[model samples]
Target: MDVGLLFDLRNPAQWHRPWADHYARTLELCEEADQRGAGGLWFTEHHLFEDGYLPQPLTFAAAVAARTRRARIGTSVVLPALHNPVDLAEQAALVDLVSGGRLELGLGAGYRLPEYQLFGADFQRRFAGTERNIREILRLWEEKAVTPLPIQDPPPVWGGFYGPRGARIAGRLGIGLLHISHAMFGHYREGLAEGGHDPRSARVSDLLPIILAEDPEAAWHRVAPHLAHQVNSYRQGSVEGTGRSTPLLTAEDLRDPNAQDTRGLLDILTPEDAAVRIRELTKDLPVRHLIFWASIAGMPDDLVTENIRLVTEKLPPLLR
Candidate 1:
């Protein structure tokens, strides 16, 4: 499995830093990971976020391309229905060129209603819209719609469909799925067959948010608050037309053990244990790349750097 890192580039109000400092620190970390032989550096997208969640991942990805010589720069999921497909094609081609052809584009129909509404996208037809966007993107690359074309003829496109029906749609599109769970596994294979593509052609990847640290308890203490903030931020949706930015939860809120939002995703493991859990997660699937959060909601620079080191060095050996 190719191990990678995922970043949302969120700088929350409580832990805010100058935007330039935040970006610089994150890029430096990416360079460190790349030098250590990380398989990829992936970014996530969201618009109008209160914590200033990354609005344009492709833009950030272009920066990563310039800083890293090895890691594959990609977006975990870009909501293409919100923009013109040709524009996306050009932007992706530019990044691919800058990165020397290391770009994996993952497209998804985002769930937040306001994002779709704000972009004037047809929310109801989002599922179909995503597929159409994928088709147009592929066609544009295939037809050389841009000058000189992308370095890779049709860089791999992935569908970030975490639902049963959507999994089949990804399969029918003959692309990859950002699937880390088994819930939609069978459906994707069936869809691939239905699309007259071999089921073996199905590629899978995902982001599992956990930390690998020497002292699990201490690491958990530091990351729990950030993790809670990350999860609870998604829950406190706005009634008005603005994006979610309020009612941020502290680590204390998540300590209840019954704090509905935790969903048991918080864990800080010894690298040894993480290797076993990861093995179990992928044993039954054809997992091409396995991703983990680089840092959860910007925990701490020193700690985040260490986690990246452990992941790129210690963790890979254990897996081997």
Candidate 2:
């Protein structure tokens, strides 16, 4: 599996920087990571957040493509139900073309009721509609319905779902699945068989939320508050979808890294330990790219810079 970077470009209010500076710093980091042999650069999307989560990942991805030459550029997850298929297909095609065919399109049936309400999408029927929209997006690309077709015969697509139903959709459609646990992948293989596809023809792209450092404890000391901010924002951000009112998480709420409260699960590891963790996570799996966050919720500049260096320069040799 190749090592990659994930960016959300979140700027929480309490830890916020100037918006332009946030974007510029992230783009510069992407460029540096790309040059330093990071295998992939992935972006994710969310909207209407207090932290200003990235709303248009493709827009930022296009910028990454222009700045990089070797690394694959992609969306780890973008909500298809909230977009028009033909338009999204056209945009994806353009980005793929600009990136010289390095695009991995990941689709998701988002659960955020607030996001759906903002987009005027049907929240209850999001699964069915999202599946349909994703298929249409693929069809448009295959049929050359959009100008400037993608450079690859067709760039790979992934279903960003963590459940059995979504696994089946991905398998039936003969696409990649983003989530993979041993149990979940059993369902994926079953779906492949049900869809009359070869069971061995499976692919994966997933996240490994880690901070690799020579000193793990010191890294955690610097990373805890940002992790707290991250966990709290997601909790607050999904209240409408989950119907759960979660009080904001504080550093006290996250004193134990193993606690359920800090579900963001940021692991601070030395490079050697991280490689071993990556192995344990993906043993006997068909993983294409295993990614780590390039920055946390506006982490300190030095910490972000150090993590980037470790991800690109230090971790690769250990994995090999």
Q: Estimate the TM-score of every prediction.
A: 0.93, 0.96
Residues 1-320 of candidate 1 have per-residue lDDT tens digits of 78899989999988999999999988998999999999999998888788899999999999999999988888898998898999999999988999999999989988777888888998789988988988899898888876757888888888898899889988998999888777788999999999888998978998886788889888888888788887777766433355435566777776668867554566688889999999988878888787888988879887788889988998999989
Worst 10 residues of 2 by lDDT: 256-265
lDDT values, one for every candidate = 0.86, 0.86
- List clash counts for every candidate, in order: 0, 0
Candidate 2: where are CA atoms >4 Å away? 241-243, 261-264
Q: What 10-residue stretch in candidate 1 is worst by lDDT?
A: 237-246
User: Against the true structure, candidate 2 has what lDDT?
Assistant: 0.86
> In model 1, what lDDT does residue 188 have?
94
